[model samples]
Target: MWYRLGQWMLRVILRVYHRAEVQGLDRVPRQGPFLLVGNHISYLDPFYIAAQLPQRISFMAKAESFSHPFTQWFLRKVDAFPVRREEADVRAMRSALARLRNDQVVGLFPEGRRREAEPPTELKGGASYLALRAQVPVIPVWIEGTDRALPRKGRWIRPAKVRIYFGEPIQKIPAGKNREDQERIHQMIMSAFRQLAEQKVAE
Candidate 1:
């Protein structure tokens, strides 16, 4: 119940302070394993998404964030596992795969780092790799206004409106051992991001 309480508290804070709005939550699978793939903008991105979803998502976070004792403890408690960006972290991948095999949701930001101005054209391969390995549905989530709510380097949180869009899942990646399939999946994710952004614009 620490997780439930935290989710409730975060939802309250986000709704009241940022006027956060979430769309397409019904698109999320009610049960079973799935991968949540999204762009990283601000430090608050994970928190914003996590606050809205009832299914607890085990997010893959950067290893550096786990360096601090308090942060490590908190992240562990929240079921977040650290990833070493500089290399192919087999351990982290194993942990993620194990979780997915257990029919748990795994959250990942394929961009590898927070981007401010431009849309992500390139993404790390880990996301696609995991998708291929787990053979699970890939949910594309688009988060907007988070950068304004909490800028990349800004210390203070601003009262900017936040919106999250969840797109339909992409399933069935062709079996392959080469990088071609991974690239295809990556392109699919990029296309989904574009569509979600257009959705936000049309609104």
Candidate 2:
């Protein structure tokens, strides 16, 4: 399958070129449906996480990415689905819920877009909604140096050192919360990545 092939290639390429240093990988749940929330600094973030993770990841990507045939094919091969980033994508939400019910790991970027800024300026509600609705554990990940390898508005692949820190599941979000409560939870998720960045993590 395309997903398997992509994963294999990614593992090799990342290990050989980037010299990726991953910490707290065991924090990821070995089984069952869980959410991987992190800062999206570059296009390579998802692939980087996929390579380091032990299980298959059903990644949630932007809908516009599927507009082209080649892109669509590549994404499909890697078990990734597109979600419209501009508005509330109910269909994508339903699709994500379905995958969660099927007990697959789903990766989402709460920041919505690839941001080079530390502690992303804004966070989206989709991640919080899915986490509460599915009653699944949410693991906060902090990825550094991907933006240098592949910037949002830059081209040309460059070799760079990358590190990913997978923090333990954040129990800040709960069921049956109001809008204000939702925003608080979203901010909490964002803060986790920033907090991790400040910590002295062992490689």
**Backbone collisions counted per model:** 0, 0
* lDDT tens digits by residue: candidate 2, 1-203: 66677778987877888887788998888888888898888898999888887789989999999999999998988889999999999999999989998998899998888876476767889988888778777899999889898876778768888888898787656667577766666777877887777763433
Provide the lDDT at 160 for model 2. 88
- Candidate with top lDDT is 1
Decoy 2 TM-score against native: 0.90
Top candidate on TM-score is: 1
Q: Write model 1 residue lDDT over 79-137, tens digit each, in one string.
A: 99999999999999999999999999999999998986346788888888888888888
Clashes of 2: 0
Root-mean-square deviation per candidate: 1.3, 2.1
- How big is the positional error of residue 158 in model 1, measured in Å on the Cα after superposition? 1.5
- Quote each prediction's TM-score: 0.95, 0.90
